[model samples]
Target: MFRVIVRSSISLAAFAAGFPLSAAEAANAAATSEEDSIVVTATRAPLALDEVPSTITVLDKAAIDRSQDIGATELLLRTPGITVSRNGGYGTTTSLRIRGAESDHTVVVIDGVKLNDPAASGGGYNFGHLLVGDMERIEVLRGPQSILWGSQAIGGVVNIVTTIPEKPLEGSFDIEAGSRNTVSARAAIGGRTGPLSWRIGGQSFTTDGISAISPAFGGVERDGYRNRGVTGRAELALASNFSVEVRGYYSKARVNLDSTRADTPDYAFNQEFLGYAGARLDLLDGRFRNRISYSYTATERENYGPLRARPVSLEARGENRRWEYQGNIGLMRGVSAVFGAENERSQFRSRSPDASLARPLPPFANGKAEVTSVYGQISVEPVDGLTINGGVRYDDHDRFGGQTLFAAGGVWRLPTGTILRTNYGEGFKAPTLYQMFSQYGNAALDPEEAHGWEAGIEQHLFGRALTVVATWFDRTTTNQIVYTPDATCNAASTNPLCFEPGSTTVRTAYYLNVARGKAQGIEAAAALTLGALTLDGNYSWIVTEDRSPGGANFDKDLPRRPRHAANASVSYALPFGLDIGAALRWSHKSFDDAPNSIVLDAYTLVDLRAESKLSENVRLFARAENVFDEQYMTAYRYGTLGRAIYAGFRGRF
Candidate 1:
């Protein structure tokens, strides 16, 4: 099946290249070089897209504005090598997987601050509440990036950069209303004065959503969600070669959810705060550059059940603090090095009352864990159009001793506008505090590790008006963490690992480093621009397997990862200051459980969008999601939103 898809995609690319299109028009549209796009996530320093040897995707502010997506997850769904599984509608629990890696294996950063939750299961960042109000760009670097990003980057890294003041004075406002009684509003203002610049933005989103659980499960309530967020940033230039920047973000959300039982009411409130401060300095006549930064993030969640009946509640909190220093130095022409050091600390706490016992239960907590790391990389160009990069890192954990990782890659560009790239890297993820100190935790568990490689080719044709890229990657992971039932202790045993094991109460599970997994995939993408019309598409074919003993899921396909996925989009600029666009997203069937007992059917979604320039500073836009209203599920028993329409207007000054 994978081979067939690849062949078909290649054939289609050839056909599109040969399609009758005016050469004059194509040349006019080819003024921009796709390979010249700048990205900062692949390496600590900014590099052109073509210079990066790994697979990456960048979405700039213009693309974000054109997509008309209010949530970050929605925008990511269109990218290659990405899959998102949401448990419900907007503001519900959402998981993002890259290259078939575990949700927690990927690192998420917003304005240099890590957003992973130490108290959450798997220590992953939840995308449910991440809005797109103040975003400037998003860069996704795929593959093992631990040499630079440290742990939890076994899959890749997602860096979100927010907007900063670029003009003396600038501001914008937007308001939108949509189906299901949804409303959203956003506003931003920013300006620069002398050597100082600052920007501030806020957003509010609310929706009367659909049932989180499918009707077949007896769901009959109208779940709803509300979210508010604010962002601020400031920068100061103290000298000609030195500058300081500070950023802060805060978001709060309230969500109504279906209860475990049909008769009960359930709701949750959550908040997140992120802060960052950094400084940059240049010395030795710009031959040496240095950066130092500090970041802190905090997350809190509260859940209430049956609000009318002495509502029982649970509260949880997580925090992370980090400090880092990085440097770049030029030793000679075409030869440079990048180095960095970082220290991080994490904490988790949770509290809940026992409703049945009518007393406060003991709080679960992990005091703190610390990790220190140092890494360095060198990029050398021995010849024209040929670049090579190699790096290594060492991480010391307060409780787990130390580990080292290495990576190497290179890019070679041919004179014919053809590029060849290859990369190999190693990654490791330390156990989270919850995984190590919780009730079912195991202090003896070792960190998970992965090694991977990728090779790709990119070609530009038709005066660079069309670009095609294809990549193949493979990865193997060892010592993966899994929960297993204790065989030595059964129903009557007093062992903590087997609470009423054989009985109906609940089986106790303990974390174990006993799993091995492998994932391999092919990704193909193409973009074409012809005068006022643009077309883009991508396809992904993945095969993932788990080899874990002591469980029924041995050698089974990973859950929630489909074998095939594809996306296509088209947009056109018409006369009279009008624009129109359409997109299609499709995924093959996937299992919802490790054992493959529960199956999620294949699904396809279509969306349409249109916008008109009402005036030089005012624009009107509208979009329709799930235009065909297909009924399907990405997760078992979770309901998906149906057809929805939204209209909005924007004003800039």
Candidate 2:
């Protein structure tokens, strides 16, 4: 049965790719937009955006510098088909959703290394700690992409590539100060000498933040946060066709916290580290390329309450190790194939101490899992102005057995400046250890599965001064895991979830795989550049529904997912080497919880920014966010930033 399923998936994917480029051509062809021509996250290979059949959005260095966003998630919010929610201010819990999918459904990759924490809720990476320090480029790919990314890509992928120096010796620095006593400083220097290239950078940020809870909800205390991080990378060329590379990233943060609707002397400390080493070799006169790598990631989190019996409230550690090999074959002109194999091991240990218990803390609850995956993809240009691609992947999980995923797409670029593209893909995610071995965990959980497709069109008009794109995407997910409330389970009861091996405490909730999810959306965007002025805008209408059989709110919209969202920005460059820009963002109302008992009202925000060149290597910038002090809540009763001002300077050498 497994072989049959795998065989059929490959065959169908090829057939789907070979079909005519009619309605199916409604995808992203040729690098998303004219300004961005290369996409790396689509097939884990660098392909011209026009040759790739996936919907992608790229943010170059110019865009990043203009936004002046302190956090990485802030920069992503303006992109098409994306939304985010934060429990409070910076350093708080932040979740980013793509096309209305769950936060964890998307995978994050930085410098060719994936990031995740098995100890975190939903086994996802926390965007709160990911600041915009030394980032150079970001690519957002929509829809299920497990065929190449393996797992945790049911929604999409965010691939971030940092700076690679173009000169022998280069240096850069930025210093920014904003409202609420917030300040940030960053610096980096790198040199490319001979066959060796190396770079190192560091950043520090501090802020006196607003309350975690909404002021209207009786919150009346100020929270503060501090963060520090460092990054380093090195690559050596042993020969013309062989090379070795190494990368490392480290970050540490501390944030104050408040209790439920009240002030408390509580705080959290977090630390994350990622290390990678890899080698590359070229065979058969560069027609065949090969790479082998090993990567390791670790995350540590701890929370403390000063007045509790034990200062430590919760402690958790998650680690991941991966070994991978990849090969690329260039059979002939306009023809190529990519294949790879990967083995990964993930483990997590956590412990929570009750403030009411005076006894010694219990030992950590531990869990571990492993997976092996192999995938193959092929791209062909059977005719002029047309490109077709198909891929297949198989993964074997120690706990959930084996799963296979398939993906196929096509791109058609016409001389008339019209491009059409379409894609189909499948995704799978195994249950996280946190959901199966935590205090209120349930071990009998099944894996989540998803399938999705997209179609879109890109049009360039008036000598490419005006560009527009429209894409429609739909996805269905089964065996979804969710936290279900169970008030009746007590310590005296026979339920294992209610009591540990020898504990006498009751449990309020448990994780189970009894939900189904569906998301459909339309994303439309346009860009017009008329000489010194540019205009860009995008709108998304996403409807996410819970379709679990016999479940409450079965037909209701998913909590926290708004049905309508839009963004617009305009920038104008003056003759005196100065640039000014303004932006507006809006979101419709959404549910606050699963029961639909609360509603988060719609709101809009406006921002104004300006920058001037002081010299060839220095720039002065300033920005005012939430210009009107718009009061809105992304998470019910959670505080949001109001009007604020910030100024900064950038220097490059």
Candidate 3:
């Protein structure tokens, strides 16, 4: 068992008032990049989309405002090469997959701080609580990007940049009410004064939600959900070439849960806290920049069963503390380098109380691990209209020894507005604490590893009024960790733990690296704008399968990973200061379990939206989601949201 230093963690989290100024600035530039062609997430450096060999999607504030979506996951679903599965309406357990990769393989970063819960089943962030409040930008970089993002980027990286004050004094507010007795309110205020820049935001949301278990499965109850969160960031310019920053985020949520067998008074509450502190230094006419930082994150979860002797059924906590030093340098006219070194400490503890047992619960299943890493990347433009980049990273885990990853990519833009690109990348992922040390854990598991490559082309026509891109990618993962069930264990099990976690009773199985998986896909996207009308769409054909030789589930489809998905939206601005839009989303059938015994059928959904400019700084908007009231399932026997309507107004000053 390991002990956690709560006070030290809090102090470290407060080191920086919030987000680093330098990284924030780079992300801001990504949002306003010329014609949305420039991106920063690809290499943590500003580069035009045409020069980025990897696939990426950027959503600026205007695009976010145009969608008028309440949650972050909802908005992200509109992007390409992504999928989401929610157990029920808002605040339920949620998973997001990119390019058919495991949900935990993706890395989520907010304002330069990585987010994950070491105690969770897969040690991943739950999309349920990521709301679209007081955020200005979102970037989705797809592929196995471990070279620059470290081990967790086996799938990709989702970088969320929050609002930063650009004016002397500015504020924004959003208020809305919707079907299912849902209501939401959010507000933010920030400004720059002298050498200090700061921002603060808060949000409140609640809803009488649908049953967690599908009604088709005999569910019958009106579950409810509630959430509250706050974010704060501040930066101080201590000198002309040096500045310090600090950022913090906190959220609390209550989600109603039920059993598929029947409706019951069961629920779970979750809390998350993130803190960061950093300082930046610039030299040599700003050509050389450096940042030193520290960050801390903690997640707490509790489940309740009212009928049980002890209402508290489960309690768990996870913490991550990190320190880093990064440097960016421009060596020559077309050569630049990004180098960084970082160390992270991750810890988790969990416990469950039994109503049947009169004795108290056993000691918490607690464990801790640490990893140190260093990475270097170089970008160069060897010839006109062409750019190439390569990167390498090395990580040393306390127990797992060491691992190395490499990536390379290149992009060429011709005079005819044609772009060609290709990329190759590798990834590494160490097992989670719960997967290696808990009762159901097997400490002998090996780290998961992956490699992937992609080739793509882009064509622009009509004076850049229309753009289209197509890409094909393939990936292979070995020694992937998976869950296994072994009802019999006499302390004589040969191989155990196959993953998923959070049970306190006698262990039947444990986590182990036993599976090999592969995925291949094609992605196509298009965007067109003519006069006051705009249209954009994307389609993805991804096939994920278990390829382990002689394995029981060999060639079976990965659970919840659809083979096909598409999204399209069209909008037009009317001369009367009103805008109308429509969206269509479709997903193909997928397996519900590893054995592929259960099947989930395909489904389609449509939504209608309209917004009117009330004034230069305010707008009124409304949307009808799931207009056809389509009934479907992303998870076996779990309910999916039906038709719902929402109306709201947003203002900025």
What's each prediction's TM-score? 0.92, 0.94, 0.94
How many clashes would you count in candidate 1?
Answer: 0
- The TM-score measured for candidate 2 stands at 0.94
The reply for model 2, stretches above 4 Å from the true place, is 1-36, 491-497, 501-506
Q: Please give, for residues 1-653, the per-residue lDDT of candidate 3 as tens digits.
A: 00111001111111111224343353354345254444556676545556678887767677788888889998888777898888877898999999989999999988788899999878988999999988777778889998878877989988887777767899999999999999999999998877888899999999999999899988889889999999988888888889998888999999989876677899999999999988889889878888899999999999999988888888999999999888888999989988899899999998777766687775788889999999998999999989999999999999899898899999898999898899999999999888886667777889999999999988889997888888999999999988766776544544333232343245666776889999999989888888888888889999999998899989999999989999888899999999999999999999998889999999999999999999999999999999999999999888988999999999999
Candidate 1 local lDDT, 1-653, one digit each (tens): 00011111111010011010111222222233444433445666544456669887767666778898899998888988999888778888999999999989989988767788888768889999999988866767789999988899999887786666556899888899999999999999998777877889999999998888866677678789999999998878788778887889999999887653452368889999999888878889867878888889999998887754446467788899999898878779878888989999999876555565555464564557999999998888899899899999999999888999999999998989898999999999988877776655667779999999999998888987888989999999999987776766656766655542122333467787888889999999988888888888999998888866565677799999998999999999998899999999999999998889999999999999999999998999999999999988888888888899999998877
**Across residues 52-86, which tens digit of lDDT does each residue of candidate 2 receive?**
78788777667888898889998889988898998
Q: Which ten residues in a row have the lowest lDDT in candidate 3?
A: 1-10
lDDT, candidates in the order shown: 0.80, 0.83, 0.83
- How do the candidates rank by TM-score, highest first? 3, 2, 1
Clashing pairs in 2: 25-421, 26-421, 26-455, 26-456, 27-421, 27-456, 30-49, 30-50, 31-49, 31-50
lDDT value for candidate 2? 0.83
- Pick the winner on lDDT between candidates 1 and 3: 3
Candidate 1 Cα deviation (angstroms), residue 143 = 0.9
